[model samples]
Target: MFIEYLTNLLGTVYKVPGTIDPEKSFLELEVDSLSLAELGAQLADDLGIEVAEEDLSSTTTVAELAGLLESRGADIPA
Candidate 1:
């Protein structure tokens, strides 16, 4: 669930340099802050949950992000 969303968002940003790894930190991806903010909004709207920009900023990996979404009642797919 979350991985698909993250992947698509990163793909749209045009700055993600390589194949995305769920375990890789967002810092490694080097996604611009503007893109991250936009992604945070999209995530909230798409998932029908409140995804804080700060939370997104501090997150370490795509998997951890999925976990956060699940914690917030996102019903992430296994």
Candidate 2:
């Protein structure tokens, strides 16, 4: 499910690069900051939530972002 979100966020076919856990840095996967922001907005839209602009800078992992969305009451897609 998470991987699907990432793929949609990046608009590409993203495979887990290694055994890297979701909590690890997206930098480890080489996702750039601009892409990450786009990901955040896409996530917000998909989940029907508003992700603040400031939060985008520090959301550095898939799990972290997911947690933020969850906290905002997003029904994370399974």
Candidate 3:
């Protein structure tokens, strides 16, 4: 669920390779710091919960991020 949402959030960017794989690292996916900040805001707005960028950086995959959201009790679409 989170992988799909995150994939849609990321949209598309040239020079980035691979699909939004659950196992792929965000850093390896070419997600920049600015994008991370934007993602933080988007998550807060959409989930009604805010998470620190530094906290997010510890995770390396879409699946991991989904787990983070789960751990925080954030909403995840079915």
Candidate 4:
């Protein structure tokens, strides 16, 4: 589920090639900031939650974003 979510979040740039481990950096996949914001908004809308723009500014990795989501009560699907 997380992988699917990530694939969609990543759009056409990066193909998430492995499990959605919360330790990897999205930057490593080449997902730029604009794409990241789009991904974040999509996540926020899909999950019916408010993902603050500040949160995106503060995060530099997929793990950190996942942690932020978790902190915001988003269920991290296995």
Model 2: residue 29 alpha-carbon error in angstroms: 1.8
User: Candidate 1, after superposition: displacement of residue 42 in Å?
Assistant: 0.3
Write one digit per residue (lDDT tens) for candidate 4, span 1-78. 454455555554445555544455666665567766777777776775677766665235666666666677776443
Model 1, position 70, has a per-residue lDDT of: 77
Clashing pairs in 3: none
Q: Candidate 4: misplaced stretches above 4 Å? A: 1-4, 7-21, 57-59, 75-78
TM-score for predicted model 3 compared with the true structure: 0.77
Using all chains and alpha carbons, the TM-scores for the candidates as numbered come to: 0.75, 0.63, 0.77, 0.59
**Sorted on lDDT, highest at the top, how do the candidates line up?**
1, 3, 2, 4
Residue 12's lDDT in candidate 4 = 45
lDDT of 1 by residue, 17-66 (tens): 66888887778777667777776787777777887777888346878888
Poorest stretch of ten by lDDT in candidate 2 = 7-16
Ranking by TM-score: 3, 1, 2, 4
All candidates: CA RMSD (Å): 3.1, 3.6, 2.9, 4.1
Of 1 and 2, the candidate ahead on TM-score is: 1
Candidate 3 weakest ten by summed lDDT: 10-19
Off by over 4 Å in 3: 12-18
